[model samples]
Structures are given as C-alpha cells and as structure tokens.
Target: MAILDNTSLQLPKENPGAEDFLPLLGTDHVELYVGNAKQAAHYYISAWGFQPLAYAGLETGLKDKVSYVLQQDKIRLVLTSPLRSGGPINKHIDAHGDGVKAIALWVDDATKSHHETTKRGADSYLEPKTLKDKDGEVVLSGIHTYGETVHIFVERSNYNGVFLPGYISWNPHYKAPEVGLKYIDHMVGNVGWNEMDKWCRFYEKVMGFAQLISFDDKDISTEYTALMSKVMSNGNGRIKFPINEPAEGRKKSQIEEYIEFYNGAGVQHMAMATDNIIETVTALKNRGIEFLTVPASYYEDVLDRVGEIDEDLMPLKELSILIDRDDEGYLLQIFTKPILDRPTMFIEIIQRKGAKSFGKGNFKALFEAIEREQESRGTL
Candidate 1:
C-alpha cells in the first residue's frame, strides 16, 4: 500500500492572470427532482440529519409543483415533485429518477451573472427573473450545464425570507439532531466518453474556474475499470467541481454505469464536509445510511502511506474510511453506496485535516471497492 510519488499527483499551478468575471458567493442550494418530495425529504431528514426549513405547494400558490426545503448548517436541499401528470419536472424524474436538477449558486447580481455566462456561449436555462414577497425580493438566473443539469444564479441580498419568495416557513414538529455535516465540499459530475475536457473547458472559459488537479485513467483505475477526472475550482476557492468520464476498462466503469442508468451525463455524488467525520458517520450509520467498505488489507499499510495523523488509526480503519495526503496535509473520506434505486447518484463524507487535493492515493482501494459493488449488481 505504498503511496504514489508526489510527482505523479498532478496539482496544476493557478494562473495568476485568470480573471473571474462571474464570481459566485457560494452554493445557494441543490434542488432535486424526485418522484415524491415528501418521502425524499423525510429520507434526508431522518437518515442524513437535515432539518426542515421551508415548503412550497398549493398552499403557497404554486399550482404545478411542490417543494420541500431542508437544511443542515450551510447546506440546503430542495426536493421537488410534479403536481400534474406531464411537465419538465416529471420528465426529468422519469429520465433520471431522483437526482439533482439545479446547482444554485449565490451571487451579487443575477442579471450580470446571466449576461456574463450567456455572452460566453453558455446556454440559457432560466432568464433573469425577480420574485417578491412581503419579506423582500430575490433575483434568479440560470444556464444549462452538462446533461440536463443547470446552474442557477441566485441573488438574495434583498430578501429575508425563510428560503425564497414563494416558499413559506415549514415548521415540522419532528426535528432530527444535527449530524455535524457542514457546507458542501464539492460536487462531482460524470459525463459521457470524450466529454470530460469539454465540460472542463466550459467551467474554465464560461464559469472562470481553474484546474485544481487532474487524474488520468492511470491515476484512478483498478484492474477491471478505469476513469479520468479533472477538478475545477472558482477564483475564491469556495466552489469545486470535479468532472469524470469513463475510460477503456476491462469491464464497465462506475462512470459508464452512472451515465447509462442516469440516461445521460449528470451529477454523480456530492462530497459534504464535516469537522468530525467519526461522529458524523457514526450517527449516519445509526440512522441507516450504508457506506462502501474496502477490504481489511487496505488499512494494513494505510498509515504507512499517509504518515502521521492526529486521529487514532483504529477508529478510521474500523469505519472503513480512506486516507490520503499531499504536500499541504491529509484528508479522510468514505463513499456511500448509490442512494437511489438506479445506482446512479451517491454521497461522500469527507474531512480535510489540511489537504486540498482529492484522495489520489486511495484510488486503487476505492475503485476496487466500487468494482466489488458493481460485481454484486452484475454491471461490471
């Protein structure tokens, strides 16, 4: 379990001259189109420790759809479902099951963000629109990204509502305890073959992101499967998106399986940050969240490669968490089995000691673990 040489880990130097025209404040909220918003919201609340925040439906004057907003610290998730038999929300759910629809970004000016991105050749998903309530007013704009997913620019400086203009405060009596899950660390999207560079370029030229790191098939492959990835980050380093595409593998790679089941390129998983992964994961497991597990051999020499850390090795190894290190520091991460029925989307729980890089050193062990799951599903 020797770690790869530091030279093999590719962390590209940031371009000093790179200008960020469309600056983002942070992730506003992730909206998912699900078959049943009520049940989906309950799952997130009970299993993932998200508390109820707001709601929108007929009671809120929304005729065509309903939405339930949940929150945990800085992370917000909006679960939406269609009210009618046929519409865009229903269509999206039919095609992709329960998956992320919008990666909403907080910004200062929604109009300016839309103009900047559209002028740079990004497809418009939502024209700049202003919504108002007694609380205040908020501006929103959006642009299409890889697959059917979209990036929504939300300008809420003028608003003081619970969630948004249309949504009312949803004070649910059953509140789950917080799991210490903080803000979103990053979101990874899986694209089609030969499409990784295209989306990466879109993030670079349109969104003004810089390449933080890159992984070829050689860096992230097992004997049976392979994939390529490149991480893109915003100017302030608050947002990160790592795009992955399947490579030629002996069998089906996870990216290929995701693209196939999701019906196209889409968000694969979201990595959520935590101050104490041990406590958070323990709570999540007790609440019925299952994580992928690597063999016992993975931990036999993990400390040898990752070197010294503040936390004890026994707990991390017992929980099947993977560790990796870079020049900055080391990070602990573990992946969940696909949460949806299609085996398309999942979640990653990550705790960074100081490391800025993804776990390149854990690639083999992680992918082998994924391959094991694929074998069980007969998709490998």
Candidate 2:
C-alpha cells in the first residue's frame, strides 16, 4: 500500500491553510535560457506545435541577449540566448543546459507582488521596473528561486506591447497547429540534500503558498536510490510546485545525479495540461518525442486497481501513456526523458478527465521506468 498523505487528492476538499487561489491568471509565460535561441524556437514551432509570438535579438538592439517567444493555448515560452559570451546567461546554460530560467507569474500588480515576496525574504532579481513603448507600458519584477531559476511577476494590465518593450511582434511563416495542451499543471524541482523543506517553507511564508502533499524518501525510493518531495500550491491551486531533495542511498538517487550533472538545483519536470492526452501523446510520439516504456506485465492487473478507462487498453499499452483514476475522475499522464544533456529537465503531458489526483497509483511503475534510465546512464 502507498503511504498516502492526508493532503493527497481527496474529493472536493483541499489542504488546510491553503487559501482560495483565484483561478490562475493563466501562465504569463515560461522563459528558458538556452545555448541557441533560434534553434530552440525552431524545435518548439516545427516539432512542438508552438507558434512564434515575439522576437528580440541583435536586430532588436539587444546586444547582450536574444529571446524568441512561442505560444500554444494559454502558455508562452521565451527562449533566450546570450549574444555576447561569458554573461550570466552563459553561466546558466553551462550549469543547467537548456532548462527553465523563469516561471513568470501573471498578476494584477507587479509592484505589489514584488513587495510582498521581497518583504518575505525573496532576493530581488529585478526591481519593479516599467518598460514603455509606442504600444504601451508593462511592469515586471522578479525574485530568485532554487538554483539559477527565478519567478518573474508580470503586470500587463496597462500593456499592449507584443511581449515586453524590447521584443517586437513576430510574424513567422511557420505556425503549427495547437497540440491540445492548454496550460501548465505543475513544475517539479530537484534540490540538493535536505533542502526540500527549506524551499517548501520559502513558498509557504514568502508567496502565500501551502503544502498540498508530501512523500518521504522511502515512498519515492528505488532499490539503489531515494528522494523526498513535498508539493506546494498557490491559493487558486492553479500553480503547483513539487520540490524534491536527494537522500542517502546504496548508489545515487536521480536528484543527486541531476545535481551532479547540472552542477546545482534546478527544474526537473514541467507538467502541461491537455484535455485529450490520448490524441496529444499519439501526436507527440509520431512527432519523434520519446517516452518511457514499462513492462507488459504491469498492464495486466492495472484495471483490477484503477478500474476502466475510456481509452482503448491496447493503445495505452502501445503508446506507453499511463492512466489512473481517483474518486473524482481519471487522468492520463506521461513523462518524457531529459530534453537536454544534463538530465535536469523533462516534460510531462497531463489530462484531467474528471479525476483531480496526481497519478499516485503510477508511482511504482514510473519509478521503475526511471530506474531503467538510471541504469543505462550508470547512475544506479
């Protein structure tokens, strides 16, 4: 039996002390630091179905950094590269590969969000600054999080600019069809030893977040590795973050392996929501994205545990997308291998078809699958 926490998905109820979060303002945008912005943008548009939305580079007068913006549904991603070498952007890429650098939070007031988080001890990355152009003015502020990652507060109430002032409206000849991905579900981070609770408290006290769920090292441990995680949620449940910390194991846990390769703490996985995961995963696989595979025997008794799924059982087996259901509804979810060389970043496809729970039932299978990767990489 799983050591289900009190805060695990349990019907219409929510975790205590978790304030009523207003429906998330939706994803403001996800900014990533990469080695090459142009190539990264192509990967997203040509392969991942994101349409080019904005652009800023040497041509845009930014001599130090270049950024490419892409969007699909409510999510936007800004891929940035250092125009000149040896800057902080280069350092970030050197450390974490092409990983998430900032998760910009959409808010009604950028200044207020900055004051609130900074007063609560968030180190200021960008002072509340307003940028204006012919289109309009946008106010943005930011604070540092674990590793080189950051959370930028975007106040766009008075802005009509394409993106920010520096970026201009980008019109690309290529625009891929929407992949059915709607919004961000949750972002997972991997920290060094015993640091999970530290960041958990940072969110609780600094950002008005609350612990939604937790798993001990034992619950998430493989035979040769162990890690601990705690889920934190914003008021509206729109933003959820799962923080992971490595623990002593016979060999090395995935978290430790990431820290070793990435050189520090950073994002581990980003879960994006979709209404039709079966179709989405099918599309993703056909587009050349690789997903983990599990043993055939694992599927033999799945129904005996989670009951029936609307999808054809054979397709689920064929594609390797895992399905699980709770009292509320069933959700389809699948994880991808590390997108970059360091093994610090990956993507998750999630579809909530009524069930409100994270796929707790898939934990054993998922970890086993991850361990197989670890074995190949010689980390475990």
Each candidate structure's count of clashing pairs: 0, 5
| Per-residue lDDT of model 2, residues 1-380, tens digit only | 01112121323424457643222344588899999999989888866788788898888888899899888777788999998879899988877788889999887777888888899899999999999988888888999999888999887767666678888888978776767878889889888888899999988888878887788866777677777888998766768899999877788778888888888998898899988888888888777788888888878988888787787888888878888888888888999887777666889999888876778788778888888998998886
Candidate 1 has an lDDT of 0.90
Query: Per-residue alpha-carbon lDDT of model 1 for 1-380, expressed as tens digits?
Result: 11111121222334433456777767889999999999999999999999899999999889999999998988999999999999999899999999999999988889999999999999999999999999999899999999999999998888877888989989888978989998899999999999999999999999888888899999999889999999998877778999999999899999999988999999999999999999999999999999999889998888899899999988888889999999999999999999999999999999999999999999999999999999999999
Cα RMSD for candidate 1?
6.3
What lDDT score is found at residue 355 in candidate 1? Answer: 95
Question: What TM-score, computed on C-alpha atoms, does each candidate reach?
Answer: 0.96, 0.93
Model 2 lDDT on a 0 to 1 scale: 0.81
lDDT of each: 0.90, 0.81
Top candidate (TM-score): 1
